[model samples]
Structure formats: structure tokens, C-alpha cells
Target: GLIGKQPSAEMERKYSNETQVTPQTPPAFIFTCQDDRAVHPDNSIRYYQALMRNGVPSQLHIYPKGGHGYGKRFTFPYTEQLQYLLTDFLNEQLSK
Candidate 1:
């Protein structure tokens, strides 16, 4: 929406997660849905790739369905699976 309304460098830096990814940045566990239309899944994918290149330990999940707002609300069909992923990732990170 903001991109379509008025594009700017500041907006891009703030809104684009990939822009903030760096080698020294903390690791992340990212998830996205295949059917998310509001924001293309590339955002997450790009960020994951950046993390990998930066040698950060990261996990990514692309659900078969769900959408942009599927997080926390747990309203999607595969929300249970996503929860499992999040739990596993957190456990592993915490143990390390």
C-alpha cells in the first residue's frame, strides 16, 4: 500500500526486511504463506537468502495456504504445523 501510494528510499529501507539483514545481525526464524497476496512471499525468501549468505542460522517455512495475517491469530488451516515449526526453531536456538 505505501509502495503504491508514495515510494521513497526511507520507506524502502524501513519496510524491506532484506535491507536490514547483515552478517552481524541476529539469526531469525521466518515463515510465510504461498497464497499471501498483500505482500509477496519474496520478502521473506529474500531475507532468508540474505541470512544464509551472512552465515546466520535461520529456518523458513512456506505453508501451502494461509495468507499475510495468518500469524499469531492461528486462524489458518496449517497453523498447527507452523506452530510446531516455531517451537522447534526456538528450542534449537535456545539450546545453542
Candidate 2:
């Protein structure tokens, strides 16, 4: 495991992005697949929730398939959609 087999409380606290989320945090674009085995979709969901709670601008996209680490892979079902969404987010941010 990336965090070691048994991560202690201090390690968890130190590595937790959600816990560090605050109103001042920058906007985010988050996406994940429901079938991702390496990282649970709930992690994205929870982080998005935290961003929303803090009134931070954010976008979240959860596809049904595509597993994990599918970035820019032509075979991934939602590759085009992901690219479009990411581009749109970046454009919107830049225009702000």
C-alpha cells in the first residue's frame, strides 16, 4: 500500500487532503470512475463534498467504468468526455 500496510493516526492526518480543505482552498476539478480499484470513488466524492461545504468552486465527474489511471488512454470509454470537461474547467478558470 502507498501509505504502508498499517498507517498510523498521525500519518492519516498528515496525508489527508480533505482535512486540510478550507474556504481559502483553490477551486478544483475532480473525477473518478466507480470501478476504480486502486482508489475508491468515495475518496473523490468526500473531497468534492468538503469543497462544496467550504464554498469552494469545484467540479466532480464520476464515470461508471474506466477503472483507474486511465488518463489520456484512447481505449477508455470516457476519454473524450474527460478531456472536454477538463478543458472547459481550465478555460473557465482562466477567464475568471
Q: How many backbone clashes does candidate 1 have?
A: 0
lDDT digits (tens) for residues 1-96 of candidate 2 = 458879999988777678889999999999999999888888888889999999999999999998988885779998878889999999998998
lDDT of 1 by residue, 1-96 (tens): 647767687888888878787888887988888888887788889999989988899998888788778766756887777778888988998999
lDDT of 1: 0.83
RMSD, each candidate, Å? 1.9, 1.4
Model 1 residue runs over 4 Å out of place are: none
lDDT of each: 0.83, 0.89
Itemize residue pairs with steric clashes in candidate 1. none
**How high is the lDDT of residue 39 in model 2?**
86
User: Model 2, stretches more than 4 Å misplaced?
Assistant: none
Candidate 1, residue 89: the lDDT equals 88
Worst 10 residues of 2 by lDDT: 11-20
